[model samples]
Target: MAGLYTDQLKLGLDDVGWVFAIEQSGSIVGALLGFWLTPRVSWRPLIVGAAFLAAVANAFTANVDGFAALAALRFASGLGMMVATLVSACLLARSPNPDRAFGAGLTLNCLLNAVFVWLMAKLLAESGYAAAILSAAGLFGLILVLGLALSGDLRGDFEAPPATPESGAVRLAAARTGLAGLVLFGLAINMIWVFLERVGLSNGLQAGDLGNAFALGLLAGTAGSAIPFVVGDSGNRARMIAITTAGLVAGIALAWWATDYWTFVAAVAILASVWNMGLAYYMAMTAENDPTGRYTRAIYIAVVAAQAAGPAIAASLLEFSHIGTVFAISPLPAIFALLLVAAVAGAPRVEGSSLAR
Candidate 1:
């Protein structure tokens, strides 16, 4: 959203980067907090409180006068949202079919994002910045209600028995690899996503066309997420990740060469879909490999940290290089992530554990 309305926010390029950084920094902090506290406390109250915090923070953000104030509010909002997000991940990680669970979650998120983006674009056209901000706040307020209705502990049904020392070591090793891969994957995706609008504009697309393309791409991401849910346990998560990574690389390449609107749209849709699908599988892999929820909780921390770094790094690169150069560099992290996934796939499974469904 900040990417789409930099002018309205009175932000320069550096300011935009800082805005994303501050918000994601807050998310990293919140994820760490959730990691520490989730096992010690009731998640219901925490989620309820966080939802209220997000609602109030975003509501106040709509009226903030300056960049600093807005940034601070966004930080608070990020913290709240991250707490909620991590808790939800913890719940989903315990499901029997974690791949499908993660895919369903991703599908819902992408669908909502697509809807909200389209709505925000329309509202901004009619009502300006305050309304758009308020609309977001309203959504957060609704989340607060949903949070209130949620019952029981955030921990899910399946709690793996305490691991043996050797098994614990193995799980930790695999989890670390998965988390590292996720961080790299996130960096690759966001590097392109953060600059997509600018890329489109540079290619002579109008603002409306770009927004529409983004909305469509998000919808395609929704479809991508749904695929795993439809197929259930396909028993080929590593293969899926590999294929999606290749598709993402191709999407980036197409985006670099695309001069026409339709070509750019196709590129964005493919990128968005494959990125979401790949991350869903990656998340499922982490959850399944480490059922204790220890490493799974930390995944959000890595993700937010990478999201904070990717654009900042890309922004720096843009100072001395062409956008195409940055796009070319973007796929390297994803390729490395795929390699890590392969390693995880080939690792020996724990006794009585199933890698293939």
Candidate 2:
């Protein structure tokens, strides 16, 4: 949603990062609280409550005129969304086939996000920013209702016994590496994603055209997610990450240089697809490595923190450097993430099994 209306939200690029940062601050806080409380508290009421909070925040978001007021409301909405998101992540981590589960979840999410993007784009065109925000609030309200229907007594599975002290230490180390990798990944992706619509507009594309491109890109993302579900756990996860990372890099480069409409569309689609595919694998790897889901919980924190930092970093960079420089530098974090993932993949096995699943 931020992507859809970021240009219309304000006139300049100078302070745009603050909007994302403030929202992410709330996300990080909510994720931390959700991670701490999820194990001890029942999920049903927590999810319902969080969804309600987000709905209210989003509902009032359009009324604010100042960046400070908008940021505060976005913060509140982030809190609600992050709580529900973390709960869902924890649930997915507990699945018997975490890879497939995560993949399927990503596929579904991407498809839904695409649909919402189209709807929001139309709402923004027809009504205004207020309607777009209100639509998001309405969606959250629907999510609240769905949470109620899906609510039940849920618990994590204990398939394997708790790790020994040494094993726990090893897992913790690996998990930290994975978390760092994820932070870098988030930074790379969000830096481009938050600015993509603006990039298109600057490149001579219409708002409607950009919206359509985004919708198509999201559909491609759905396919990317589906690939992991189709391949399941038997495929080489590390190799998959490397391939998707390469694709993402190429896509970013194309977007940087794209002069034609079709070129931009293709670049956007590839970028969206590879980003979704890469993260699905990353999340699955995190869940697989940490049986207790603590590492998985940390994934959201790293992601939110990176999201807060990425756009701010990009915005600051724009003060001195060209947008092309921003795009060129974007892939550096992803490359570092790839290397970290490779290192985790190569770490010595414990109990005759690789530390990373």
Candidate 3:
């Protein structure tokens, strides 16, 4: 949508960052509020209310013109989306098998995302941006309905018996490490992902072709996220993150080198697949670090902040240097992220066990 928004509003590529940054600002605020309130309130109302808010905001988004109005609407939408998202994350974090739970959730999400991207492409082509935005609003409306139907009553869900002092200190340290890693991981992925359509267009691909590529790529992402669900908690989480990160780096490199459409499609597939796979492992690791879901709320904050920063940073790089430079530096954050998390929770340590020394 960033690409399309640029064309619709006649914005430069760097302006895309401003849009994402403004939206993410609302997410950061919502995440902070969720972090503070989850321990005090019920998740059901929060989710339902947030969904309604987002639905309304997105519905009105089609009627707005100019960057400021669009940003304001998107910011409202982001705020609602983030609050709902963090509540869901907290619930998943408290699950019996957090790894498999998060995996299943992401698998379903990516599957839906594939269809959403395709639909957005078609809607924008046939009906213009308003229809696409209205469709998003409609989707949020559906989420509001689902929240009413599916969300259980879970007050005091964040309450947990305190760990012993010795163990508590260790878990806190490890959770902080993993959260930092998550920040980097989120930054790296979104930086490239937000610009992916532009990358393809620069290489002579049509919007429809890129749309098809994204759809196929996100289907691969569904499979990638599902691997953890299939493997369950028995699989090595840190090792999985490392492998997926390596694949992501390779895909980024390949995307930079790709000249042909098929080659670009292959790169998109790999990039989408591995980053989503990596996300499951990252979230699972953070959840494993803290069962109480307190830190998990912080995960939303860290991720939202990074998601905001990634585009701004990438946009800056694009402004100051070549796209090649953006590609060159992009993988470094992911590499650093892997190193940070693996240092604390490397292989040979099973899930829910104390972080490896």
Overall local distance difference test of candidate 2: 0.79
Q: Judged by lDDT against the true structure, how good is candidate 1?
A: 0.79
lDDT of 1 by residue, 103-151 (tens): 8888888878777887887888899887887778787777778877777
Stretches of candidate 1 off by over 4 Å are: 1-17, 121-129, 155-159, 162-168, 202-204, 316-320, 354-357
Q: How far does residue 279 in candidate 1 sit from its true spot (Å)? A: 1.8
Question: TM-score: which is higher, 1 or 2?
Answer: 1
| CA lDDT of every candidate | 0.79, 0.79, 0.77
Instruction: Tell me how many residue pairs clash in candidate 3.
Output: 0
Global fold similarity of model 1 (TM-score): 0.88
lDDT of 3 by residue, 1-357 (tens): 566666778877677778877887898888998898877788788788999999999888777768888788889998999888888887777777777888888888887776787798789889988898788888888878877875567853655445666666666667777788788887887788777777778878788887777666667657777887887677776777788888888888777776667777788888877866776677766776675777777888888778778888999998779877788888888899878876776434443355523
Worst 10 residues of 3 by lDDT: 348-357
Evaluated at residue 195, the lDDT of candidate 1 is 80
User: Which of candidates 1 and 3 reaches a greater TM-score?
Assistant: 1
Two-way lDDT contest, 2 vs 3, winner: 2
Question: lDDT per residue, candidate 2, 2-46, as tens digits?
Answer: 764465566356567677767878988998998787777777788
TM-scores, each model vs. reference: 0.88, 0.84, 0.84
Give the Å shift of residue 213 in candidate 2.
2.5
- Model 2, residue 180: displacement in angstroms? 1.6
